[model samples]
Target: MTPPDLSRRALIAAGVAAAAFGPVRSAAGTEPGPIPQDRPVRIAMILYPGMTALDVVGPQALLAGLAPGSLYCVSEAEGPVASDTGLSLVATHAFAACPPDLDVLFVPGGDGTPAQMRDAALLAFLRDRAARATWVTSVCTGSLILGAAGLLRGYRATSHWCVRDAVLPLLGATPVAERVVFDRNRVTGAGISAGLDLALALAARLRGPDYARTAQLVAEYAPEPPFQAGTPAQADPAIVRAADAILAPLVAGATAAARS
Candidate 1:
């Protein structure tokens, strides 16, 4: 029997339908079937004032593609959450409205991390969600927030270089100075730009390396920075000193917050 020829519009509609009800194929040649609608992977990202915009946005760009309609920006109250640089990202869900069980619980680091560390409600939310989350993750200083929530006790984590060694110990977490550190389902990324790498790793874990590689290819994530000064080790002494000066206040506040 011959199949009927379809118009371009019909073909486009079919493609959209396939995307909506597509099977998540694994690299091992698993049979195609629709993902269980009732058990979609739920991702919750915490947003707070003074957070680094890139910390969350970088990871979200990749993670959003992994599961459409699953990623959520959550906060104490749903509204525009302001970042350190005055950029605001809207929180679609409030802490109370977010799902009880999450596949991924993510937080972003920023100058406001110290304040968030001291926020009892936010800490409680993190603690609760992390208790059942498959992955408790953070980018940069977000690890500090997780530690404050008592979620990172005895866990090896990473954070922004400025506070990695200074504050994590105070919160009972072993800090590693790396781009991304994963210790038993707790994944932490160091600094703002590392969020992309961290999300890619999580994507690979959740889906497969093939999916992550395809995402990377789609994003053209090849990096050729104009300068080799992304890290303190690679930067000039004067530049490193300047950067430290800018971060001194945040480091001091986070350290104090960790202790208290």
Candidate 2:
């Protein structure tokens, strides 16, 4: 089945697109329990320098609501990391310092992602946790990190259109250009802000479709952007070139960062 596709603009215009919806804590009547309460939903978002805040923080926000107090900001460092936009974000845990058990692991992307893609230490962190994690996910170019770790070797995944070309060949991943893509245990979101789509999908899968629907209602995920085009094939050629021009340096920076 063809998964739904959405652009970052669509997400912003909606403000989730709905207003009256309430917060969703846990999926009612759907709990993957029988495990210890000490674990606390265990979602660790990996942080890096020059990353897009939306790619990491947006989904984390939604997930944060669902699992309050459990959402943690883990990093490969001990201090604040510089974002793609030059914002410094404080990290809670370093890659090597995180706990042994993580229920979910999410990686976000941005101008720093390509550099993160080739980071052996980061890849090892993912690989080590992936062996025991309940779910593994990535946002935007973050999927390339998963591919670099060899987790998406045969899966159809999604990433930001600007970076899909780079991610496609690295790990034999069938890179699908979509808002969100899921292949069993691995879930990925597209563009800078598509993390919400991926998170809602995970919410549905982890709990139930109703949980996702409820979240959609709460997040107001119904409205589409004023821009008629969501997919590149459906967009005007000029728009593509314009966006490409904007990302060229960031892409180059990511490349240089990764190699250095």
- Per-residue lDDT of 1-260 in model 1, one digit per residue for the tens? 43322233321121121123222333332322223433345679999999999998888877775445667899999999999999999999999999876778999999999999999999999988877677789999999999999988998899999999989999999988889998877889999999999988887787556656766666679989999999899999999999999999999999889888
lDDT of 1 at 235: 99
Each candidate: RMSD: 6.8, 9.0
Segments in model 1 whose C-alpha atoms lie over 4 Å from true places: 1-39
- What's the lDDT of the predicted structure labeled candidate 1? 0.82
Error of 2 at 111 (Å): 0.2
After TM-score superposition, the amount by which residue 6's alpha carbon in candidate 2 deviates from its true location, in angstroms, is 25
Each prediction's Cα lDDT score?
Answer: 0.82, 0.71
lDDT of 2 by residue, 55-127 (tens): 8777875565444455678887878988989988889888877865666889898877777777889999999
The model with the greatest TM-score is 1
Query: Residue 220 deviation, candidate 1, in Å?
Result: 1.0
Worst 10 residues of 1 by lDDT: 10-19
Measured with C-alpha atoms, the lDDT of residue 66 in candidate 1 is 48
